[model samples]
Target: MTEAEFIAALRRMPLHPGAHGLMDDSAVIDAGPLVVTTDTLVEGVHFLPQDPPGDVAWKLVATNLSDLAAKGALVEGVLLNYPLGDSAWDHAFLDGLSLALARFDARLIGGDTVSLRGPRVLTLTAFGREAAAPVRSGARAGDALWVTGTIGDAGLGLAIAMGGTGPEALRDAYRRPQPRLTEGRALAPVVHAMMDVSDGLLIDAARMAQASGLAVTIDLDAVRLSPAARALGGEDRAARLAAATAGDDYELLFALPPDVTPPVAATRVGRFDAGAGLSLFDTAGPIPLPPRLGFEHAAPR
Candidate 1:
């Protein structure tokens, strides 16, 4: 659908009180200490048509929640932009959506839904209240780069969901990506800057470095990856590189001063330098990162 047509269709649904009548490029919600993030997933781009409808529902919600989790935001409320499908399919999708939303006691505050004549596209604008806004430019040099749990699972999970499966252990990684909500909140007060690893570790770390005007040197071997990542992710080389660059692992990647340790379990993967660039150190000299990074849906499928 055209942009205007899409907007018009969505505006017909029940909207948030602060959506400004669905006219502007921004929404003004009354959520105090608001932390806002919007994410979009398109059919044939974000997910395959043959994939289970329940999983589509789950990942759709998980991805949006991941953005909120990255910002250290609680699930205060959400505005969903759903491209309505068959009634039975919609019913099942809501069931899956409910499962994921219930995990954080979050609900759809208000949103717009409409029937689309083409592939399904889902957008979620989520908001959470924070006592203080956590910005990305707060990271500092000498601050430790930490990752909660493992990385590369979601990428591998996506790989499995597509068709090729090196192992079954990777299914949960793709189907249900958990946002590090607790870890984000715990570090917000102490950490310099925080974001979830929705993209590859290398890319996200570089983003933090660029935003903070610093450099990030990652210890590739120090990265945390699941067994499946080691297996299907090209065993050794792919594992390291994919762990370095694979996107969609919704774990927390945060920065903190050298002396301070996170109150939660984390792995120190790297350090930020005073300069502005990304270096991956894996026993040898640092490896330069490419510019075309992260998961881009608008690009070629």
Candidate 2:
């Protein structure tokens, strides 16, 4: 089954009201401002097998926290599901986990561990608090689309990790992504909808538009690229498209009224309209949609 099929199947199972039909990334429980989210990373899939254990641990924690950030929730604590591995790797992972938790001001409440088997798999569940959590489906037509921080740094970082030449900053970006918790909190009350860009920006934005029953048009020239990314990839239409489709950005993508200024620094890349699908344009006028929008999981046969 494909990812969509799997999700559709899961939707048939018993679900709580907080599940939001599993349409959103995080669950907003009615039990006193609580929000919860979980994420899993496979060694070969999410991270390179040769990557440092410490960075892997940090990535695991950050990915989950990114979900909470999209919900504009405050990080309270996390539960880790770790696999016991070699003493050296285990020790390094714990060290990285310690630093990540401390940096995020989150504590490790509890979790279960198991013996390492096959490819290493790690999971983290984060709990947070927010009175009025925003969902991706809340976006509306005429809302101006916004995104936090620069895009595509992590994509270049991934290339560096895979042995391509690049700056350490890019590599660090792919290894240790910083979740936009502060930005999310500040934008929560003002934005119509929001979500972290884990998958490619185009795909996530398309999701927001689909969920809200609207159409979105992204201005390729408007998609911001970091200095490093621009220096390496240039500012051509191809480069901008690459950045927009590269995943693991971990930045918040939100929708706000065109007249309102965002409290935090963000780039306005697109807008929603009363239509059905995503559209693309640049300084050169309309562009055809790319064949592939973003990274997606393929089910094993």
Candidate 3:
């Protein structure tokens, strides 16, 4: 079954009391406002087999933290699911995992390790604390949409890792994504809605729009691209569209009142409107929606 189908199947089963109806990325527990999120990365799927094990470990931790960040929670600890591999690779992964946890001020309290005969799979469950988890469904019409950092850098980074030419910064972005933990917590109070842009900018925005039951009109010219991404994607309508649809950027995308300036570095790229669906436009005029929005695991057969 496809990933979405599998998730849907799980939703049909009786859910744990704290489960968020399988709607949000993380689930909230009744115990002291704890929130938890889990993500799994598989070899040759999420990451290239040739990718460094240390980087893989870094990504595994950062991605889960990003989910917690979206909930406006402070990460307290993580539970690791590590599959044993060769000694050297396993050691490298542990070292990287240690550095990542240290950097985020989170501890690895507990986990499971087991031997696997197939592709390497790494999973992490992050625990966080917050009085209330921010909801993506909170966006409203007339909210200004904003995105942290530049978009499309990670997509270019993936290309560099795949033998395509690119700068090291781009490659580093793809390998080690910086989760917006501090920013998420800071913005939670003022923003109307918030979510991490792990997928493409356009697709994630569409999700927020759908959740809010409003239309999102994105101005393509306002979408930010790194120097490396600009060089790789060029400065045309199609190029900008390509950047918008490229996924794996872990920056936070949010909506706020137009008068409220973001406390952190961000760019205003769009606005939520009183309608359903999403619309794309540029300086010249409206642009046609792409056939495919972003990374879709369960595509129509």
Candidate 4:
């Protein structure tokens, strides 16, 4: 089943009210002012089999933290689920995990480790305290869509890691992702809706729109591409389109009033409307939607 279908099935199952019916990126526990999110990375599914253990560990933490960031939550700590590897690889993973946690000023509270028989799978459960109410859903018609950081850097970086030549910056972007925690904290009081762009820009935008019960129109030309992505993707409209559809960009995508500027560096890529779906536009006019919006597991056959 597709992820959406899996979630749909979950909606019918018994769950805590704090679960938000599994509709959000993270669960909001009612007992405490805490937000929690968990993410899993398999050896081949999320990362290349030969990827550095340190880099993989860093990404595992970063992705989970990104979810907490979206909730306008302050980093508390993390619980790790580690599968035992060889001594050297395990040591490198711990070093990387330590670096990431220290860089974010978050602690590793505790977790479990086990011996796996097949491919390695790493999991991290991040806990955060709600600084604000946690901006989950509030977007409205006429809200301007904004995104932080340049798009497609990590996508191009993945290409580089797969033997496609590119600048080190692009590779670094993919290897070491930066979760915009500070920016999320700053934007919590301002944005109408906010989410991290873990999928693709277009796909994530569509999700926010759907959550808000509105239509979002994205201007292809308005997206900001990193210098590294532009250099490798070429200087053309198609390159920009490719970047928008490429997943794994952990930037922030938010919506605000048309006239208000975000405190963080961001680009206005689109605007929400009183409709029910998404529309894509280029320099000329409306364009056809791409076949695949972003990464999805177990696509319908």
Winning candidate number (TM-score): 2
Off by over 4 Å in 1: 1-31, 288-293, 296-301
Q: Which runs of model 3 end up more than 4 angstroms from their true locations?
A: 1-31, 298-301
Model 4 CA deviation exceeding 4 Å by range: 1-32, 133-136, 298-301
The pairs that clash in candidate 1 are none
List the global CA lDDT of all models.
Answer: 0.74, 0.84, 0.81, 0.80
Rank the candidate models, highest lDDT first.
Answer: 2, 3, 4, 1
Error of 3 at 232 (Å): 2.9
Backbone steric clashes in candidate 1, count:
0
In the range 18-83, model 1's lDDT, one tens digit per residue, is 677677655666777777777777888777787667678788777777767767677776777787
After TM-score superposition, what is the CA distance of residue 46 in candidate 3 from its true location, in Å?
Answer: 0.5
What would the per-residue lDDT of candidate 3 be over residues 4-47, giving only the tens digit for each residue? Answer: 44345334434444555556655445447687788889998889
Candidate 2 residue pairs in backbone clash: none
Give the Cα error of residue 123 in candidate 1, in Å: 1.1
lDDT of 4 at 136: 38
| Model 4, position 235: C-alpha lDDT score | 46
Give the clashing residue pairs of candidate 4, or none.
none
